[model samples]
Target: MTTISALTVPDERVLHRHELLALGYTPRRITAAVRDGSLVRVRRDRYVRPGTDRAVAAAVRIGGHLTCVSALAVLDPEIFVFAHDHVHVHADRQASRLRGPGVSHKHWRKSEAGDVRLSRRRLTEPPASRHLLAVGDIVGQLVRCLPEREVIATLDSLLHRRIVDEPFLREVFRALPARYRRIAERLDARAESGTESLLRLLLVELGIPFEVQVRIAGVGRVDFVIGGFLIIECDSKAHHEGWEKQRSDRRRDMKAAARGYCTLRILAEDMFHHPEAVREALLGLMAGHPRA
Candidate 1:
């Protein structure tokens, strides 16, 4: 079986030295493994799998847990729709030596309660890994750092993926500040993508009449069907990229058209990079298209 060992750690790729040593790998053998490219060194005492994610490695190298949306991205990249690229780290408040590339945000927990012993925030720091932070902690951090819509989008992803359930969400919400707790009500697991969740948030805020992932007899399941007649699809580049997918989508739109449904596909970039333009276009479309 393949094994990994590293003397130090800066990433998830690093394997534990103890695991190898316990497996009867002598120091000489470890060195031989390194020399033969069977093991790669991330730092002194840390050996890891060769093909681990770069951001994950960077966070571990920085002596911190990868966390927040950065952790979410590693865990389920498809669920990511918010515009955050930098690796986020959760580190010690007193760590003096924190230096690395790719880590733009670092988080250290603090207690707001007067007595530190009675603090609500977790004091425990789990083993640093490619994806660190508990689901509740991740949600809490998202509430603190991201905007309302973005947080809801992530929450929707967690819910849709069954990474979290209603009870878990309630517990998480109960711990949050009152103002933020209410946003939890807007989460809908029917959102299949971060972009879909984002669009749902817009529709919710605008009080638009719409249903998510509605299936029409002729057109199959759609991202959103608005006012019973308008079909809105939040197309991420991954979904609508090639000519094959585009051709398939056109066929679906053609099918929807036969049933008197108007389809409006929005590029995910437009939603992320040009929100106002997308909102205006949707508003114009809704105005012209009569409601069912």
Candidate 2:
């Protein structure tokens, strides 16, 4: 039996029986703490103080660490947009099959010649089970795991919030295959939201020349300015759905019109669900205003 002391465990509040024993705690004392409600068993060997993050608890329950978008969300919930309902977990390729409610398991396969050097790189840090993949590793996994549009949106969010710089993202891109490099090239740090980033990507795919976060004399700052005279507003519900915001938007549109700019406001639904309609409307707008 190993000697244990209260001073040996750091303040993280999670502990394993082995750790407690090494710190001079007896098995009897460990049982008493659990019985008295001072420690909660997360699993067979893992114990944590009450009120740990449920997602972290879930990751521990699945016997893996959070990675990809799930890790990004945990690292910075303010900026990273992890829209999926399932909690993402990362485990070794040879690990046993994972089964649980609301868990998305990602197996780390051996890295190929062109794949990111996931195995060789020190992208993971650990206390064994509760480890988290580094931000750069998460970004690399994101590109490989998510759709291209989603990758752009996530990267744009990361860039816009200055959570990660362009150089760091370029490094992440370099870890990818040649075909995936275009995503890095198209990234813009000025995008204010995922919707704006998605809209910008759509416009680029349409071969439209645009400027982001353009300011007009009367209108505050428009999302995107195309051909120097057309204002495109990608309206996210959280920001633009309120009556006060709608009124402010109308005022801005009128101000833009006075300054010889035509405003096209595209809601989240229009841009996401009816993208072709958005394309047609943009084409129509461009054709009607040749100067724009």
Cα lDDT tens digits for candidate 2, 74-118 = 666666473676565665555564334223343323331121222
Cα TM-score per model: 0.78, 0.76
- Candidate 1 Cα errors over 4 Å, as ranges: 1-14, 32-37, 41-44, 81-83, 93-131, 290-292
Least accurate stretch of 10 residues (summed lDDT) in model 2? 1-10
* Candidate 2 wrong stretches, greater than 4 Å: 1-40, 49-51, 80-82, 93-131
Name the top TM-score candidate.
1
Residue lDDT tens for model 1, 64-172:
5556677677666656548675566665566655444333234322332111111124523344343355556656667776788888888887777776676777776
